[model samples]
Target chain A: MKISGAQGIIECLLEQGVDTVFGYPGGRILPLYDAIYEGKIRHILTVHEQGAIHAADGYARASGKVGVCIATSGPGATNLVTGLANAYLDSVPLVVITGQVSTDLIGADAFQEVDITGITMPITKHNFLVKDVATLPEIMRFAFRIASSGRPGPVLIDVPSDIQLDVFNFTQEEEQEKNKPRFQWELSQLGSSLIDRAAAVLETAKQPVMIVGGGVVSSGAYEQVVALAEKMNAPVVSTLMGLGSFSSEHPLFLGLTGMHGHKRANLAVHGADVVIAIGSRFNDRVTGNKFKYAEGKTLIHIDVDPAELDKNVSTHIPLAGDVKQLVTTLNERIKPFNPSPWWKVIWEWKQEFAVKPDGNDLSATWMLKQVAERTKGKPFIFATDVGQHQMWAAQNLHIETPRSWITSGGLGTMGFGLPAAIGAQIAMPTKRVIAIVGDGGMKMTGCELFTAASQGLPLITIIVDNSSLGMVRQLQQLFYKQRYSESLLPVPMDFVCFAKAFGIEGTLTTTQEEFLAAFSAAIESNCPRVIIVKIPTEQLVTPMLKPNSPLDTFMDI
Target chain B: MGHHTISILVLNQSGVLVRVAGMFSRRGFNIESLAVGTTHVPEYSRITAVMQGSDAIVAQVVKQLEKLVEVRAVEILPVNTAVVRDMAMIKVKAAQNKKLEVLQLAETFGAKVVDISNETLMVEITSGKTNTDALIDALSSYGILEMIRTGVVGLQRGDCSIYEKEKCEISALFDTAQVEA
Candidate 1:
């Protein structure tokens, strides 16, 4: 049947099992909004384009589906940049649709026209400018496929207004068949690349350490990761993205390894002779100094994206394929080994440098532990913004479920929590979604509270208000001889009042008991709630790797 | 760090070159010379990019290039076992007196004098980089006014093609049955 291009977009979305999308419409995208109104799909109108994009990212990460968002030309398109970069870095699959000026006016710098495809080229997995309505269906299909495929990322489709008004015949069944995966492309052949030798290396090593990254969750290799760790008798360390890929409570699991990673985990990695890094890109945050990182260790790196194999550090054995498949094959080939002696050293280090709150004061660490304890045994999800609180949560939160832990790992994006939590709550209506934000992070995208309240999402936003940019201050104190210039928030606006303005109940907690009570109440509430947990000014993420040092290096505590 | 020629097969489409070029600049790899054109299969295009980098950087260049959705295949051809060509047109400020010497020098390099005027002689050469550079050098003393090169394009020797063997497999001797198309 012949249909308008906007309706064809709807048809293509339905063909791909997408029943909902998050977006903010504008003048150039009126036709798309009209089609959305007539279509059966649910369209979430966020307060801002940034909120819409982040919500889609959160939806994708939480629901394991391709997240969709839309925006108009110029400012609407540019506002989605941070979210695009965030999704790109963290490998979240998002289909972003932007309305562009008419084809005749594209290069004329027409009103509200911007070169969105050019701007998003470096950040997105792939992007397209719909030259005509004829390719709309295929472009939409490929956009989703590319976004949701190997090493998933965000793909943008910039359709001109004229194309949205154009007519096209889009049959869902025929079009779907015609648009089957365009490429039989494999990043690398999953064979004897590093399997046999890597398994042998793990089995024979006296001190072997396995480091898991976000790839574990993406590949659904959690169970295999557990099995492999047990079979090799190697202690497992989780990257920021690999938080919930393995059970935090597992005896072999040493939580979060990186700059702000657990002290014992860093020591374990530094002392290991063999490092089996699975599904990790080894970003700078994880490697203190690339030259000094694992200098003598034999590195076995497995990642679905081959470009990331040796991008940061050289890999002794680069196994480029799906992490789940590679780890499963490695699991089958390897034999169990006894690491009693390794465990002895790990145990001593664990006892010597366990991750715990230093004092009894109401700190970020103290607040995070209380939040984690209050939400225990409940169907819960924790989404965090980047800051001291994020690091504290990574260091403290005990997550056991894959996809349960969602945060901006690679981009370390601020203002990601509120909209992300709203999206997660929408994706997982039955589960409790909580947003953990620092004062600084909350200030960046705090306006998203309007979205949560308007949608009536049961998202609990916990603002760990340190009254300062705590991480920046901590850094200055370490390097600048305690010259905490400009890092302090001299004018502290009342976050509780701000939350109340958004039609959400707000509470201020200064003590541990008060925080627990507020947190528990928020958990029970069906509507959005914001709790401001005031922490000490100097709260820091300790065991931070100093410049030009190894992972085990740190400043004087 | 040395230069390596990487040949890529990508779907003939707009914005594909920008994607490849963007990845190069984003990853800090330097493109010494690049030539792009359609292949015999009209649906696909070939991009011959010569990049300067270390072995690891070149490995990343090839790996990163293959990640593009439009890119079908990539291979780094060995320097010795390949036939490379660079097409250049150099316009030299030749007086009526020096035209024959420039012509004779260009003839030595198998160059054609495509255009001639009393003020200048335009010499064109399609050969390896060495021959093209030599022809330009021989005309430089005659006051070469302008010059342009079509970068460098190459194909592996013997029976193997980029589609049949990647990384310019020197041992692709047995795959003689598969045609280049």
Candidate 2:
């Protein structure tokens, strides 16, 4: 039963139910890679370590399981920071394993050595640097437990080269079992008094608006949220992180609420009598001017993390527990109540500010609508990068289920879509996955398309080419008097050529018909494909609130 | 803005101090004085940070600190109900002519003369903020040579401790938060 640390890692991952890992190999991690080469676990070699981490993040979001990734020390580990922070902010479960220099060479400034655990301390839920081979199994177990447990996030396990090569008896199950740390937080501790208080508040509310967050998806509480929303007859609005928690097609579903949210959604929150904020921390973007946000309303904040209760906005009643439990309890205790008048008011607002697709050539909005229509009544996953296209997708895509839509909400990291799509597709092979990306964001991590093509992922990447950083350009046009400096991509890059170079098929579209044809073709290709839709640079995401502006105030285009 | 003294209990792990400081700086909160040291439990470290801000901002800082995995507890110690102290050592020129006066002033402030030179006297004192300020102010007249002060460190006056369960067991709260998937 004796095994090398490298072999032990593979064994540990197998025991944790990990079927695949996304990683890039390097000098320090060669032994681990060798071990993986001899094992049955699938290891995806991404173009960059960042892409690997992001792909793992996407897999976790899509599969509802802890995603795993591996990298070598130094720059390899540094590149994972943004992805780690993204997962941390969104509460995605991930186990990131990094290879370190030999134990003797750790502090000697040897080649490819860095204090990765120190660098990732604030970003990860927990981290460990294994100097002893005997402790590897236990630390690996704890890493998974910590990553998937309460307020799940990425955990780092730094395995030194020597430890990986060292031999240890792998049959010490009794000792390893004893080392497993017992996580104490339980759902039963949530007392009934708070549920009673919340029910009373709901009973008295006339215009209630429920704010669902990513916590619902992370905790697998989608049905519970749907039940509560239906029972109360409340309009459901979501934070950017909360996008897929409730079905976007639901009648009561208002679109994404915040800086670039629907005009009606923000207005609904402004006029709400009771704000039931579930699993949301009220990001600054969502709460424009904190002091005035949800003012004069009874705030009921329910979350798994107690620290987020009053961190952003004030709360009248705080319920700290799992979203599933709290939502279920509320569903059982609270009676159905109709807010038809408020619904009518919201309907009027939606009608007044409804998005109208223009007849412009290859419009991103129109393309998204076509994709939504063609994919309607079917299961699909849409992942997006940050920018105008991201907002457009969130505002236009027909997301029908939880974990069906993925985007970088907290960090707003660009270059996230392609790799994330790769991850999601890998996690769910039978479902259709699409990457809706902008020119600016695609350029950041477009190289990952090579991974999708090489693996024959059958993923479609829709590149919304506006030839500029659309979001920042819009900001300049609005606030800087149209002096767009350093906001434009110097040269118009062609995604078709890039896709071809990566061994992927690509098509350029300048009209609605062409886009639909190219999209349909890509869907039929059964291989990774890119459809570049040329959008006009002047187009902007509407209903954006200026920084420091009140929540109710927005500059609608 | 009023100054507030807050104590944080954290797992004795690497880079935890940097994480706490980074959070404060990133959030635009300024720390007036800070001290960190191992506590009664070797597994825990107590970080005493003094910041000047409104009640809401201070509360936000505390909540953010509590979010860190290594941070086990966070408690804001009110001045009237906590024992807060700062230690300082001041070196002053004390020639034969002014030695008596310096010694007398030091006596009134309960300062200890840890180092004495032919022409200088180094007095060390551990006391609250107000007393330390007064002693420094009085000693300034004698042309103080050099001085150093350890930042404020505080603990609650009653039986309640920052590490105690009922006061601030952050891990316990997190454990309770873990719902079965």
Candidate 3:
């Protein structure tokens, strides 16, 4: 039947199984907002467009479904760029629908007009500016398909105000999808010869270490990775993005590997004779000194995204396909083997660098440990911003489920945690979504607290107040002779009052007991709450490895 | 120098060219030459890009190009197995006294005199890199005034099309990859 462009968009969203969208409405998007007001789909009004997009990203990460968001033209569109970039780097699937100026006024310098398609061309997987109402349904379908398929990423569709005002029959546009060109290089499952070759590499390994990355989480290959790790009797190490792919409490897990990675995991990769890299593109942080990264290891790299195969570090054997499929095939083909001799060294390193919570006056790691202990055997998602607190959260939080750990690993975008927790909580309502944010990063997007609190989301923002950019300060102290330039926050910004101002209950905890009490109360409250924990300024991410250094060589802290 | 030519078959979409070209600059790979034209197929635009880089970097580019949604297929054309050519038009200031010499030089290089003026001769030539550059160098002696060259473009010199079922159809491999080991 006939429908307005706004209704057509809502129809497409429903067709694609989208139940909710996050966006900040504006004058240009009034038509779409009217449809949203009258439609069945839920729309969240975030205080900022950046918060909306990031929440969508977090929802996608937590729910394994394509997240949707919207914004008006110009500055509203521009505000979504950083979030789109973050989702792009993390490979999170999103369909961003932005309102645009009228067709006649597009380049006429009308109010709120911007070249969003041109601006987002480099960042989005693909984008389209809809000038014709006949193409609305088709463009919307294409947006979701492109965003969710292959290597998942964000796709933007700029709907002009006049186009949204136009009326068209959805059936007419449905026929156009049949003629759309199919991508030939859409990731095809590779020939088993490569799998055979990979098995041969595994067969000859004396000390094998399986390193998983974000690919595992994105591909939902958690069980297969666990099976392979168990079958081979190998220790599993994850990159920052791979945190939730395998259980943190699993016996075989060796924690994160790379710069600021666990010493056990780093040393394990360094000592490995054969490294099976699953889904992790060797990021620069992970492959510090690519020349010396895996010098003697027989590296087998597997990734769904073919471009990532040898983009960073050269691999001896490259398997390009879906991680879930490849890992399953590997599990079936490779015979169970024991690497206990190698595990002897691994266990030694694990014990030597084990995380022990001692006398804690709200140290980042110690606070996270208490949270982890209290929430043990329970479902929780720890979303973090970038910094020492992010590393601490990754190291200390017990994420037993896939998609439980949501952090901006690739982009390391600050102000990500709070908004991300908002998305994750909305996606997984029953689970506790904790925003483990730093003092520095929280200031970037703290307005998202309004979004969370107003929605009555039970997200806990555990803002670690170190009164400085602790990670940057540590870098300066180490290499710059302790010249703390502009790294420290100028004033003592009380996060508790900030939360209270947003109509959310909050508490300030200076010690472990107080923090634990407040945290327990927040958990029992079943509503949004903020707990500001005061961490000492000197506390830094341990075992910091200088860039371009081998993983095994860390500076003496 | 690790110079390679990549031929891409893409959906004739409005932004496909930008998407393909953007991938190169996005990855920091300098493009030596790039040419785009319609193909024999109705909905396909063929892009031939020449670049200088290590084999690994070029391979990475090819892989990245294939990931674009509008890209139908990407193949790295080997220099020996491909028929790469560049076309150029050179205007030389061969006044009345030197017009014959310029004409004779164009003839020797099998270049066509596409345009002529009272004081200049514009010669057009299509050839491989060496011959194309050599002809321009030969005309430079006659005081070349202006010149324009189409960047390199070509396909594999054989019966094999990029769309051959044996090459493009991924199902056979997909079937094998799907079977339980």
User: The CA-based lDDT of model 3 is what?
Assistant: 0.86
Candidate 2: which stretches are off by over 4 Å? A171-192, A357-361, B166-181
lDDT of 1: 0.86
Error of 1 at A535 (Å): 1.5
Q: What TM-score do all the candidates reach, one by one?
A: 0.95, 0.93, 0.95
Candidate 3 residue spans exceeding 4 A from truth: A172-190, B165-181
lDDT string, candidate 1, A408-443, tens digits: 999988888878888898999999898999899888
- Candidate 2 chain A minimal-lDDT segment of 10 residues: A182-191
Q: How many Å off is the CA of A335 in candidate 3?
A: 1.0
Check candidate 2 and list the clashing pairs. Answer: A184-B175, A185-B175, A185-B176, A186-B176
Ranking by DockQ: 2, 3, 1
Off by over 4 Å in 1: A174-190, A356-358, B165-181
lDDT of each: 0.86, 0.87, 0.86
Q: Could you give the CAPRI-style class of model 1?
A: acceptable
**Tens-digit lDDT track of model 3 for A444-472:** 99988999878999899988999999989
